[model samples]
Target: MRNVSSPYLLEQLMSRLVAPDAPRLYTNGQPWRDARGRGAPRHAVETEFKAEHAVVDLSTQPPKPLVVKCLVRELRIRFYAVSTIKNYRSAWVCFLRWYRGPLDQIDQEDIREYLELLVAGGASASEVSVTLSALRTGLDKFCLLRCTVGLVSPRKSKQLPVVMSKKEVQRMMEAARTLRDKLLLTVLYATGLRVAEVARLQWSDFDFDRQQIRVQLGKGKKDRYVMLADDLLPLMRQLWRHTKGVGYLFPSEGRRVDRHLSPRTIQRAVKQARILSGIGKAVTPHSFRHSFATHLIESGTDIRFIQKLLGHTNLETTSLYTKVARMKATAVASPLDRLRDEPGSSSESSGRQPKPRPSVGRMRLEVDPNPDSNGAYAVTLGVWKDGQLLPLPGMRATMPRQDWVSLQIPLQDIWEPTLRCLPTAQRERLESPEFFSQLQREVAKRILRIRDAEPFQALKT
Candidate 1:
């Protein structure tokens, strides 16, 4: 490897592999050590020239021009982030290909053809918007203001959101296999929380006594309070106990205390749940949020209250639920039945049939470890049915009402036990006064820690 020279800077660019400390002019190997030979190596050169034509080893291509590399380096130093660097570079690279060479030599006609090429290639509105912006920014910075790269505009297309119904919501919820999964789904629906908002929820955000959840820096970077369901409070307390030492509510794998569960994990969970639910309609975690707003309005909850809960910047955005909310029966005739009564009406010939009623099974739940303040000692009564494990209760009603058992296990005990033994199903068992008190104590400890977390300090910035 010999030193390469810069055409623009007129300075020798030594290859670190060869001249680790000194400069050497760009030339074929050794600069022909015996310069008096028939083909004397060209030296004493100090003029700008394209070196791409220079002879070199058959191996790598010549390094990029120092001017171009410096341009890219300066682009980064100007606070144009890396993503911007790649995008702008990519856009200009396309422009270079369009004009065929020497981009500064290209005029308005070349740029217009390039924009036409982009549109003819079927780029979407958003993609074209990004590409045009990238091109404009690059040209503007590189003194190509006379170029017509700015003339192109993006295509416009209307996109409507998919909505879900109540039954679909129920199916999605039922698909969640674990208590944690179920609670996560519930919070998304119950609070109308965006996926990111849910991932960022800290233990300190919850107010157990007030039954309210304070969402800090929600969508549009605003804070608001959402009402917490009384039913979820006790379960949350048990979860707090399970994740006592964890920094984030849903900690990432490998027990990295400061890391929260990634948003993609929750998104995947929602996607799987949707598929398992056999839902025909297209739905997303956001559909749950939409459903939450629609359901509240259908139930006659005040629109203003729903707005506050959803943390919408504008009331009109919240009001979209009005159109989606399902209407209750109000002496309305069945349109399908009316079809049977048309001019060709005949109940016998129409083959009208009575609807079958579905059987509702009793909601069953059983306590295995029994109620406990610490919530550390508990296994699902149902899990015992697996012959290798604890015995299962046949029915929730038959399980012993033996009063709440206090859990005094050390923190290490919880971690020491195999996850198989840490029964999460028991967490949902009937709540006890003692358990709530324990939760209050834990909340106090969490609040103090949150006040001192590094993120809290950064928030001041």
Candidate 2:
């Protein structure tokens, strides 16, 4: 292979991926190449650019790049991230299973049919997009084929991110069992680092003097600095002293001290925190990143600044926070508010009181078949009526438990959940009030939802 001029910043690709899994967690399961190491960095490892099909060696046994081994070699030659290579390999395997045609010979229609097959098999838009992106990139870079050029991906429905309120964040932190867990949750929301980034964080990355954390080689393999929370610095230091972690900030659990914590572990911790905090917002690790950006926007930070802090190459990506953010748009005064009094404010209309919950010996939850803006199904369990369960069609039971109850809540605050809702909603901190009252109501609804799920419907029997 000859030294070639490529469009990519080849130098930036150095200091990473030369050694195999040296710092697995930090470098997406690959090690950074030490410049001080004896060998030359693997940058200029590709064949010379071809003119009139002269670059690629068509004379080989497998005719080069057509074989999986050759394709993987090409990926390493270009210094692609380990995660990228793994994902691309999976996508390639899937594509090969679907279509047996030659890689360089597949036409636009073949690509379209494969995409349709993926859609028909119930692959989500994001999943389909990843597969298509992998094919486009792998084929173009390795085989120099561009079969998916005119292919249009399935349009995705953009759901607003689940953003936890500041109070909810406080409660989440309070819910963490150990100091390390608390620090993990705090760093996530404070710095807006991805869960993976937090998992792979090193002590050297923190610059207490500058109050910034250098996020080296993040999502797009781009390094950028993010603000280190002043309030969190004390707790961070305390945990640092407690754990004595050096290479990776949050080391793995159960005696694998050499490796950093897995992203799944952090996710589980965040989920546990959400449960303890009594929040039922399907909170994931990414929720903290979304909340960080949204809260910053709500606090009136410039969009461009948020973009740089997030290490987003595109401003439009950072601008996504604006949709979920409650800022000037939410503060816009409604013209109806100008009239303090209604056109005809009378005692009959103005002083109408809400009907109180019906007094009953035993009130139970019933699933409502209605769909609303909040979610697909709702449990109508607001207030009872006339010795029977009254369905509040318009109301949804979404407000998380506001008070701190006993650590052992059963028989006092919340009811023991049934087996049906155990798998999915076990994390759900069911509401409080009475014996088998609000808490049972939420559990019953989750049970119904679990039964409604296609995969779990068999369990309904």
Model 2, 1-461: lDDT tens digits are 64636534354355354586545333354544545666755567766645244223323434333565556667778888988789878887778777765544767788788888988999999889888887777665545555777766668998888998999989788776556777898999998999888998998899989999999889878899999889887887766664674778888776887799999988888887777567889999999999999999998889899999888899988888999887565569676665546566464467767766433333455554454575434544333334544332323333232211121122321323232223333223223234234343344335434433634446576
Runs of candidate 1 with Cα error greater than 4 angstroms are 1-122, 132-156, 301-308, 314-320, 331-344, 348-351, 354-461
Candidate 1 — worst ten consecutive residues by lDDT sum?
Answer: 395-404
RMSD of 1: 23.8
Candidate 2 off by > 4 Å: 1-66, 101-104, 328-331, 334-340, 343-461
Residue 35 displacement (Å), model 2: 54
The C-alpha TM-scores of every prediction are: 0.51, 0.62
| Model 2: ten consecutive residues of lowest lDDT | 401-410
Name the candidate that leads on TM-score. Answer: 2
* TM-score, structure 1 vs. true: 0.51
Residue 271 accuracy (lDDT) in model 1: 81
